[model samples]
Target: MKKVIMGNHAVSYGVRASEAKVISAYPITPQTHIVELLSEMCANGEIDAKFIKVESEHSAMAACVGASAAGSRAFTATSSQGLLLMHEMLHWAVGARLPIVLANVNRAVGPPWSIWTDQNDSLSQRDVGWLQIYCESNQEVQDTIPQAFKIAEQLQMPVMIVMDAFFLSHTFEIVDIIEKEQVREFLPPYEPEIKIDTADQHSFGNLAGPDHYMELRYMIQEAMDRGLDVIKKVNKEFEEIFGRGYGLIEPYRCDDAETILVTSGTVSSTTRAVIDELRDEGVKVGSLKIRVFRPFPTEEVFEVLSKAKKVAVIDRNISFGAHGIFYQEIKSALYGRTDIPILGYIAGLGGRDVTPKVIREIADKAIGDEQPERYINWIGVKI
Candidate 1:
């Protein structure tokens, strides 16, 4: 079934389809709608689940950790400051090997205080051990939600589904919403190996001594490494059932592209439009949308950019003094490969427009062999 929906609503549908047994979250801008819908569903008996409206994001994640530990499928969501508040429990969620799913609506961090879009919020938690999936459209948000559960539970690791603030979060689009029966056939109920309970009154998240700590960390790495395959398998199943397939990185017209654009989140949509517009003008350019950011698909990126004559990376977040966050990663991914010229362009902070014109301008620069002087060059900004 297809319906016109907001990104947050699409996410809510995904949650319902996943049959999440527990949902705990705080009310934060852009992120509040997701929980609101879930709350309505829970109250209306549309979903058989527990909706815990915690006072703070920290408690929200804590509740999810508790629910997941109790062998229930749990989910939660938060934005910039909210995610920052839950920083500590992030380690607890992954370290305890709980398969929790969180929706992080990306927002700009504040010194001057801004609630609009930026990647810094979620990217700031890149080291927190959660598998992060950056979404480009409401459709991807809907699709990735169920897929995230499978990935998280299979790996026994928590995952973050990152959608840009205001863009994917608040934007409306017609999405091919999956059927409930189809979703049921695809993602069955979650049953864990061990859960927090009275019969098995075993301690969870207990402090591991030097004797067993190293092995636990190693197991996490092993699970994450194996997650790549599991994710693909789940996506294949999703495509078979839903008729749509997604990947860690989605390549657009890269087969014979001379200049390539690398992007994530909603900007990829604008880049796609630019690619089509440029193609009609006889320009050999393409685009790549990177959906999965955490398990940073390095080898796959190299495989895509290997043939391009030049590459341009557009990012919505900065790494302070370094470079555009995704740009730095893409450059590192292609390091030592002398085939293509790569340029990094930073754009659209505070929810500014990353329009097709801006994308075409970037393509023009790369096409003309112009290089960015700095790693964090702003686009669509007045000089």
Candidate 2:
């Protein structure tokens, strides 16, 4: 059914459709509406699920880890410092190999106390082993939830569906909320072979000696290696049922283009408009929207980007002492294979507007440059 809803409610609708058994999350701004609506759904019997109200994000994730370990489909949501607070438990969920799905409203970390958009919080957890999928629209945000659970259960890893703070999280959009009956056709019941069962008890996440520890870690890598194919398969099945689909990387006009701009989350929407404007001007440029960040769709990215003479990465995130987070990933993805001039542009942090003009500037700079002056360029910094 189609409904005009805020992005947060879209997440709730997704979870409801997926039939998540245990919903645990603490209320944090921009992300609070998700759990708030889920609470009402549980109260109204709209969703037959256990809603665990916790004091903090830490407890929220811990509850999800416990619930998931007990063989229940668990879910949670958070933003910014809240996600940062769940850091250790995030690893616990991964180490325990529990398939818990989380939605993180991308926000800037604070000393100045900003509660607005940026990719810092989620990208900071890149090493924590959760499969991260960034969404460009409310529909994708809603759709990714079921897909996340499918991938998580298949690989026994946690999944995070990230949306931009206000742009995609608080902003209202017309979303085709997939009904439970239809969603079930795409994502059936999640039944894992291994889960915490006291009757058939076994230790989990125990201290592993060096003799056996490395292989356990290696297994995670193996599962992640197969995850690319798993994601593709899941997307194909989801599309077969829902008639809409997305790829690991959505390359727009990249074929036969000289310069390509790379982006993720809501930024991709504006970037596309810039791409269209440039195309009208006879500029041979394109845009690549990165949907999945983890398992880093290296091959797909390489195939599209390697053909271009130059690639520009637009990040709403920054990694201190280096370039943008996605910029670093793009560099690592194409390092030795191509000598193309890869440029990094940082814009739209802390809720700053990343308008079409800003994206146009980046594209113009990329298209007209003989060689980039530096690896990373700040788009609109006052200094």
Candidate 3:
């Protein structure tokens, strides 16, 4: 059924459709509505689940960890500092291999205080063992919940569904809400091989000594290594059943392009429009939207980008001294394979609008420059 709803509610509907047994979250700006609707659904019996209201985001994630450890499909939502507070538990979820799904509305981390969109919050947790999927639209945000569950359960790893703060979270759009009945076939009841059971007890998150600790870490890395294929398989399965599929990376008009722009989240949509405008004027430029960020999609990214003459990555978040997060990843992906001039531009930080003019400027610079003198370029900064 089609319904006009904001992105937060879209996330709620996705969790509803997935039939998550335990929904636990602490309210945070931009992400509060996601749990608010889920709480309502639980109270009204629209969803047969336990909506655990917790004090802090830390406790919210801790509650999810406990529920998921007990072999239930678990979920939670948070943004910015809320996400930061849940950092310890996030690692717990990954280390325990609990398959909990979290919807993180991407908000800029605060010092002076801001509730706007940026990738810093989620990107900060990049090394943690969680499968991350960045959504471009409300429809994709809604659809990705069930897909995240399926992928998580299969891999026995937690998944984080990320979206731009207010851009996708507060903005309303028509989404073909996937009903629970429709998703049951795609995501079967999560039956883990091992879970907290009183009758058949098993140790979870137990201490591993030096002799076995390295192997346990090795197993986690192994799962992450296999993540790409599992994600692709699940995406294909979802497409076959639902008539829609979002790949790890989406390359638009890249077949015969000289320059390509890399982006993620809501920015991808705007970048696409810019690409079309540039194309109409006989400019050979394309854009690539990275949907699945974790597992990095190195091979797929390489294949699409190698043929291009220049590649520019527009990052909404920066890594302080290093460079843009996505820029670093893309450069790493194409490093030894191709020496194409891959430029990195940090734009739209702290929810600043990344308008078409800004994108055009980056594109023009990338195409016009014989060679980029600097790797990291900042856009729209005031001295």
Candidate 4:
């Protein structure tokens, strides 16, 4: 059915469609609606699942890890400081190879304390061994949740579906929620190929000797490496069933363009409008909405971006003493290739509005010939 739903509600619908057997979470602003809706569903018997209420985000994820280890499909949602609290268990969930799905409402990490949007929280945990999918729209948020579960379980890794804190999370949009029966047909039940069984009584998470430890880590790497193809396969099946196709990285108007803007999350929507306006004016500008951030998708990014005359990276998060977090990654990906110049535009932090006009200005600057000065250029800021 089609309805105007908030991103959080869309996520809850996806979780229901995915048929999560165990949902555990603590309430955090911008992300609270997700857990609240799930709780109500569980209370109303809309979903046949156990909604575990924990004290903190840390315990929420810890309990989820335990539930997942016990061979149940577990899930959680958090934002900002809440995500920071889940830091330790994030490693545990991945190290134990638990197929847990987490919906991360992206918010700026605080020192002065703010509750707006930024990608710093999730990007900070880039090495935590979870398959990270940055969402562009509420529809993607709803669609990717089920796919995240399938991909995570298939690879024995956790997955984090990231959406902007307020932009997509709280904003209402018309989304065609996938049907329950169809999702059930597409994503099978979660039965881990390798699991801890009471019948077997084997010790899990035992300290491996040097001989076995390195190999175990190597095995995890292999699983992540293979997840690229696995993600593609799952997306293909999802598209076939729902007639909505997606990729690890979605390219917008990249074909025959001399320059491309690389971004993720809700900002991609703004860039799309900017690109269309530029196209109508006979200016060749395009965009690449990076969905999968962890495995980095270096090959696909290179193939799509390397040939362009210039590439502008607009990031919501900045790494201290470096360029925009994603901009740096793009630079590293395109290193040693002198074909395309890389420009960094850091914008939309702490819930600042990144309008189409701002994106157009950035695109105009990117397509121009200027000596690259600062690695990080602040956009939408008063000089």
For model 1, give the 10-residue run with minimal summed lDDT: 369-378
Residue 189 of model 4: what lDDT? 91
Candidate 3 least-lDDT 10 residues: 369-378
What C-alpha lDDT do the candidate models reach, one value each? Answer: 0.88, 0.92, 0.93, 0.90
| Per-residue accuracy of model 4 over 1-383 as CA lDDT, tens digit each | 89999999999999999999999999998899999999998999888899999999999999999889989999999999999999999999988999999999999988868889999999999888888999978898999999999999899999999999879999999999886688998899998755678776767899889889888888889999998999999999999999987798989999988899999988898899889999999998899999999878988999899768889999899888887999988988888866577899988888888888888878888887486545567887777
lDDT of 1 by residue, 176-249 (tens): 88655778888878888788878878887678899999999899888878877888899999999888888999
Q: Is candidate 1 or candidate 4 better by TM-score?
A: 4
Better of 3 and 4 by lDDT: 3
Q: Which tens-of-lDDT digit does each residue in 230-339 have in candidate 3?
A: 99899899999889989999999999999999999998999999999999999999999999899789999999999999999999999999999999999999988888
The TM-score obtained by model 2 is 0.98
The candidate with the higher lDDT, 1 or 3, is: 3
What is candidate 2's lDDT per residue for 1-383, written digit by digit as tens? Answer: 79999999999999999999999999888899999999999999989899999999999999999899889999999999999999999999888888899999998899889989999999999999989999999999999999999999999999999999989888899999888888888877878787778777888787899999889889888888989999999999999888889999999999999999999998898999989988999999999999999989999999999999999999998998998999989999998998998999999989899999999999988888876846579999998
Candidate 3's displacement at residue 281, Å, is 1.0
TM-score per candidate:
0.96, 0.98, 0.99, 0.97
TM-score of 1: 0.96
